[model samples]
Target: MKIVVAGATGSLGTQVVEAVRAAGHEPVSISRETGVDLISGVGLTEALRGASAIIDASATSSTSTKASIEFFTTVTRNLLAAERAAGVPHHVAISIIGAAKVNANYYAGKAAQEEILRAEPDGWSLLRTTQFHEFARQLVGHGKLGPFQGVPQMRSQPVAATEVAAELVAIASGDPRGIEPELAGPQEEKMSDLVRRYLAATGQRRPVIELSIPGAWGRGMRDGSLLPKAGTRRGRQTFDEWLATQSR
Candidate 1:
C-alpha cells in the first residue's frame, strides 16, 4: 500500500514516514518542504494520487487560538477534499487527548479539526493521544530568566513518538474505525519532574518551577483533563526509558 503523509517534515510526521517505510509501504509526502501547501490546498490532489491512505500529522506551533484554529481547520478540510478527488479511502489523523473537553491554545484547533472529521466520520479514523515524551524537552527549550525555568503545572502520560507513528501507520492501512481507542504512556508523570529529569539527562543545570497557568484552559491542564482514561491503549515506553535513548 502507498501512504500519503501530510505534514511529513514535523516531529511526529517524520517518525510516521519512517514507520510507513518500515512497514514495507511506499510513502508519498506532502508538506511545505515537499512543495505542497496544505493551507491553500495547492498540490494536494496530485500528491494524494494513487495513495491508499493519507495520515494527517499536520501541526502548528502557534499558541494563539485563532491561528491554531485557522491552520488545523483549513488544513483538515483541504486534506479531506483532496482525498475525495484522489479516490483515497482512509484518512488517519492524530488529536490531543481530551481536546474536545479543553479548548485552549493548540487544543482549540484540534477540537475544531475533530468536528470537521465527524461530518463524514466513516471516511476517517481519529486517534486521540497524550503528549509525546519529547514534550518534556520542549519545556527545556525555554531559556531560564535566572536560576530556574517555569513550566506549566500539569500531569501527562507521555507516549513515545515512534510508538504513535507506528499506530498511525497501522490505522491508515486498515478501514477507518471512526474513533479509535486513545493511546497513552504507561506511567503518569508531572511536568516539572519530567523537565528536571530531561535537564539532568542532557547535563544541563536548571531548576524547574511548576507554575500555575491562568484561566479555564490552565485550570483544565492542571486539573488532569489531558490524562488518559480507562481502557485507553497504553504504550510500553516510560519517560525514563525514552530519556535513556537520548544522546548525552
Candidate 2:
C-alpha cells in the first residue's frame, strides 16, 4: 500500500514513516519542512497522488487558540479535499485521548480536526493515544515559576511514541473503524512526578514544582480527563523504563 505520512519529521511522524516502510509499504513523507504546507494546501494534491492511506500527525507549537484552530481546521479541510479528489481510501489522524474533553487551546485544535474528519466522505479513523513518554522532557522548562521549573497539575498514562507509531501503522494498514480504542502506558502517573523522575534519570539538577493552572483545561488535567479509559490498549514501556534508556 502507498501511505502518506503528514508531518513526517515530527517526533511521532518520523516513527510512523519508518513503521510504514518497515511494514513493506511505500511511505510518502509530507510536511512544511519537506515543502508540503498542509495548512495552505500547497503540494497536497501532488503528495497524495497515489496514497492509499494518510496519517495526519502534523501540529503547530502555537498556543494562541485562534491560530491553532485555523491551522488545524485548514489542514484537515485541505487534506480531506485532496483525499476526495485523489480517491484516497483511508484518513488516519493521531489525536490525544481527551482532545474533546479537555479545554486546552491545543486540544481545541485537535477537536476541530476530529470534527472535520468525522464529516468527511472518506473512511476516517481517529486514534486517540495518551501522552508520549517524552512529554516529560517537553515539560522540563515549560511551566516555570521564579527561577523554578514547574510542571502542570495533571495526570497522564503516557506511552512511548514508538509504540504509538507502531499502532498507527497497524491501523493504517487495516480497514477504517472510525474512532479506535485508546492507547496508553502501563500505569497512571502524576505529571510532576514523571518529570522529576525523568530529570533524575538524566542526572539533571532541576527541581520540578507542580502548579495549578486555572481554567477548564487545568481542571480537566487535575481531574483525570486526559487518561485513557478501561478496555484501551496499553503499552509495555513504563516511564522509568523509558527514562533509563535516555542518554540525557
Candidate 3:
C-alpha cells in the first residue's frame, strides 16, 4: 500500500509515517518541507499520486480564530479533493475528541475539518482521540505570563502520541470505518494535575494557575464535555506512564 502522510514532520505525523513503514507500506511524506502545503494546495495532487491511502495529521500552532478555521477548512477540502482525483481508496483524518462539544477556536477548526471529511464522496475515516500526554507541555507553553503559565481548568484522558499513531496506521492500512470509535487514555485526569506532574518530573519550577476560560468552549472543557463517552476504546498508557518515559 502507498500511504500519503500530510504533516509528516510533526510529532504524531512522524510516528504515523514510521508505523506505516513498519507495517510494510510505502509512506509518502507530505509537508511544506517536501514542497506540499495542504493549506495552499501546493503539490498536493503530485504528492497524492499513486497513493492508496492518506493519513492527515497536519496541524498549525496558530490560535487566531480566523486563521485556525481557515487553515483547517482549506487544508481538509484540498486533501479530500486531491484524494478523490487521485483515486485514493481511504482517507484517514485525526481529530481531537469533542471538537464540536468544546466550541473553542482550535476545536472549531477541527470540527470544520471533520465536517469537510465526512462530506467527502471518497471513503473517509475520522478518528477523534483525546489529548496527547504531551498536551501537558503544550498547556504550559502555549501562553506564559511573567511569573505564571496559563493552564485551562479541564479534564482529559491523555493518550500517548505513539499509541495514537499506531491506531491511525491500523486504520490507514485497513478498510475505512467512518466515524470510528473514540480513542482515549486509560484514566481521566485534570490538565493542571498533568502539567504539575510533568513539571515536577522535568525539574521545572513554573507555577501553574488554572483560569476559567471565558466562553462556551472554555466552559465545555472545564465541565468535561470533551471527554469520550462510555463504549469508546481506551488506550493502554496513562498520563503518568507517558510522563515517566520523559525522564528515561
Residue range 1-248, candidate 3, lDDT tens digits: 99999999987899899999888999999989999888788799998999989999999898656777898999888888898899898989999888876656788888778888777665999888999988888777675767887788998988888989889989988888888788998889999889888888988888888988878778878888878898889999888878878972
Reference-based lDDT, each prediction:
0.90, 0.87, 0.86
TM-score (C-alpha) between model 3 and the true structure: 0.94
Q: Which digits, one per residue and each the tens of the lDDT, describe model 1 over residues 89-188?
A: 9999999998889998878999999989988848899999999998888777763758888888898889999999999999998999898889999998
Per-residue alpha-carbon lDDT of candidate 2 for residues 1-248, written as tens digits (9 for 90 to 100): 99999999987899898899899999999988889999788899999998889999898877666777888999888888899899998999988888788746778888888888788655999888899998888777465566667888998999998899988989999998888888999999999899889888887777777889788777888899999888789999998888888996
Candidate ordering by TM-score (highest first): 1, 3, 2
Which one wins on lDDT? Answer: 1
Regarding lDDT, does 2 or 3 come out ahead?
A: 2
Q: Give the candidate number with the greatest TM-score.
A: 1
Summing lDDT over every window of 10 consecutive residues in candidate 1, give the lowest-scoring window: 137-146
lDDT of 3 at 171: 90
Which stretch of 10 consecutive residues in model 2 shows the poorest summed lDDT? Answer: 139-148
Cα distance off (Å), candidate 3, residue 219: 0.6
True-structure Cα RMSD, model 3: 1.6
Model 3, residue 80: displacement in angstroms?
1.2
